[model samples]
Target chain A: MSDASQGASALTPEVKGIIGATAEKIEASFPWGIEREGLRIFTQAIMDPDPRYWDDEFAAKTKFGGIITPPIYCTYIGRRTRPGADDPITRAFEENPYSDGIQGVRTPETRGGLPNIPTPLVRTLNAGNEIEVRQYPKLGDRIFSQAKYADIKERVGKDGSRMLIVTTETVYTNQNDEVLCILRASSIRR
Target chain B: MTTAQELRDKKQTWWDDVDVGHEFPPLVIGPLTSTHLFRWSAAIENWHRIHYDQSFAVYHEGLPSVLGQGSWKQSILPRYLKDLCLPDGWPWKVSFQHRAMIVPGDTLTIWAKVTKKYQEEGLGFLDLDVGMRHYAETCPGRATIVLPIRNGKPIPYPFVPPKKLSEQTS
Candidate 1:
């Protein structure tokens, strides 16, 4: 754990300024597309024993009263890997089976899982995810989202390594533009 | 005695049943294996080699072993909270961080203890401390859920939050 100390100002005014700024891209048509089969696989993988996610008949009788996907779909909604959209990461997968892992891929890129932070601080960890749901996403509702760098702050870790905690908030909506949920995803970068 | 699974199956976790410090029945999954991780990766289309590539992860990356996906671990707590609501209630929000690395063989207990309960907008709300504990608390976070009071109206369909979505931004 090399403590690359650029001090607290490592956020470089340019970096700090990007905080609260919306990503240049407003992503639409996610890879999964919030479909039923995809959600079935996604939800069942954890084996929650939640009948709503597993049993269609039970879900239909619930308040949702229709095919509804879990709200967790909000996180993976806008990934740019829909079949052959040709993002860099997608290209990497296309060309090589043994390519580099998704190290720099997920850090700052609000869309495409491409890193967007303009700083020397590169290593990133999943700090946390905070999601507020107005609704559980129903199958067949078209999804759209806008993401912003909600906040960025610097602090020293327990081992004395300085880390920048970057938070990006993405608000998801349906094709009708009705709000669905808000996800505040925080990461530790050093 | 009424079992927790019975409540989940019947969708009957009423407001009277929850108090601060009340614990939700733990939802345990695995002694997970590589196939479990691959199934998740295939389902999500996440090809990050660390999740499934044991050679690359252990030999190249030098991780203890092929690690469980962060996304998978993160989803456990939220899913647990969501299931607690069943038919009528709603999982308003959940937040958690991956504090420890989990390898393939870890048996996970997705668990929570109610920390607070209150009524708002005629809806019953529960706030809880949640975790995915495998030997230690590997993932820890907070979750808030909305449920119906014993005999009051069921939680609104599609959930009408106390605040507007616009206000919830940031």
Candidate 2:
């Protein structure tokens, strides 16, 4: 079976049924509100040393009047918050970092934003995103995210290859219900 | 309270100082490694193996090496822009496309050039062409930023996009 046919036929009825479905509730960060320490770790991980991210005195003088997370930091805010002993996956992963580590930590929201939608497509690529920020989140702000399939369409390439373009719209909001930003991300699955 | 003038004096590029062809200083990050990828992944709780597992990415996935996440690349741009607009303005809106893929160990230099500049509803707006380049250009996109005039009011925090964008819309 060729790549094109393989992908086309793999779009089983069950898989196609998930189109237009809402993705599971996935908070981009922990529920405890954005933490100062976590913000520092993120800045350092990205090699960003902006004082505005950590220097409270300097930040207080800025227009924000407080330290602010990077505009896109909300995307990575999800951390394991106060792991509970009752959660087996969390406990198992904590007990041994390498024990089924992949399965233990992976969530349905991680792969293309919609977990396990049956598709024969073996190759998936991040196409890109259009992002709008109404406000940059601040430390101690509770960040939440909700995503849904805005659209799903199949297209044929110049080489007569078939691919699925999955577009997801995710809105990030704070506990006050003030929207932080919206990400319209599209992924190519072939 | 700290005066807006103090902030303006700290960083001095204003609406009047910019030109259509101005290019801000380039921001270079990476020569990245699995450790960098792993750290970022762990921060976000993303257990995507293709980002950190070489064997799975290469043999099983047929990739050249561990791949960098699009979000990783996307998150880095705001740092570059925020630094450029420091002391007086904010990065209002941005859009970018992952035209190409970048693997770990590639040092990415992000560059932005002003293609247009205008004022609307008392704010300075700059349209920019931005992208990441290593051995070859990987991600290319455009951004629209709102700046403050030298003696004008500072860009409001918790930025509110101009209600009237007719003069600045592209």
Candidate 3:
């Protein structure tokens, strides 16, 4: 076939090793904690004014039972303890020379102020996402995540470039085996 | 003191007499940081170190912080459409394309304009061009949504065939 396909096929072995190694590392420790403050930060960032996330009284009356976190709040549930430095995604982009153009802090021309993060990376573009929620986590709930590299493969687009497709699956759960959410995402490394 | 009832009562519906060119309400989002990025990673079960570790980000490719997830941007679209349209406005189809990255502290303004309206099979459909613009640079992403008009009935499935076929001999 083409060079891209051959390159992708050659990567299967290496990708498997990476996935297995990363899964073992993540499963061994609880990387982060889910808390109310984190919930507020995430919800406010999205500009969601739902009382369920802000007011305890209104949340109590809703079907959610109590201070229920927003559905999108699931994005911020993890905490990392080890490296004790910059965020992992940022580091991934910074290290890769090909991605430098996409990552960095930008200025808002209209507002005339510093952007929230001094440097932002548009490094990883969206390949696709699948989300299934079993139950919503309420305020004060403690949760953990099990992350693993699900699969990796390659494809050649009509443009003739070999693209590496990496798929990862993460399952979130409470102290009980009750699944909170299951997220599967794919990224393209070209 | 203003009561929650007053706040809830102030919620507007699309039926409250809307103008075609009027802009939908504006929304401010993010003073985002690595913390939020990490939380998103943990919640999404993404262990990509770039989101939480600044050193990894800077040393590796030189990013300021972990990048925001693209799916998060896509998910925000439905909510924006729901807010702009009335409760009776039901979405039939939605398509999105991510043209740029949304980092922490980016204020996004989401708005939509009713483009076309037509009646098909006793159902009313409004075509909308929905958009999200980064207030800082005016970089925006847009989508087209086919939504059902308020109080309109849904079109029935298995529409009659347009033409009759000739009888076949067994």
> DockQ for the candidate 3 complex?
0.06
**lDDT computed for candidate 3:** 0.49
For each candidate, the DockQ is 0.52, 0.42, 0.06
- lDDT tens readout by residue for model 3, B3-38: 335433444343324444545565445556666666
Question: Where in model 1 is the C-alpha error above 4 Å?
Answer: A1-16, A24-27, A30-33, A49-51, A54-57, A84-97, A101-120, A156-163, B1-8, B164-170
Candidate with the larger lDDT of 1 and 3: 1
Name the best candidate (by TM-score): 1
TM-score of chain A of each: 0.71, 0.72, 0.60
CA displacement after TM-score superposition, residue B132 of candidate 2 (Å)? 0.8
Q: Per TM-score, what order, best first?
A: 1, 2, 3
Among the numbered candidates, top DockQ falls to 1
Better of 1 and 2 by lDDT: 2
Q: For residues A51-137, what per-residue lDDT tens digits would candidate 1 score against the true structure?
A: 665567766876777767667776675543556544656556566656754643333444433237776778888778898888877
Instruction: Assess the local accuracy of residue B123 in candidate 1 as a C-alpha lDDT between 0 and 100.
Output: 82
For all predicted structures, in order, the TM-scores are 0.83, 0.77, 0.48
How large is the C-alpha RMSD of every model relative to the true structure? 4.3, 5.7, 12.8
State the TM-score of the second chain for every model.
Answer: 0.89, 0.88, 0.65
Worst 10 residues of 3 chain A by lDDT: A112-121
lDDT over C-alpha atoms for residue A40 of model 1: 72
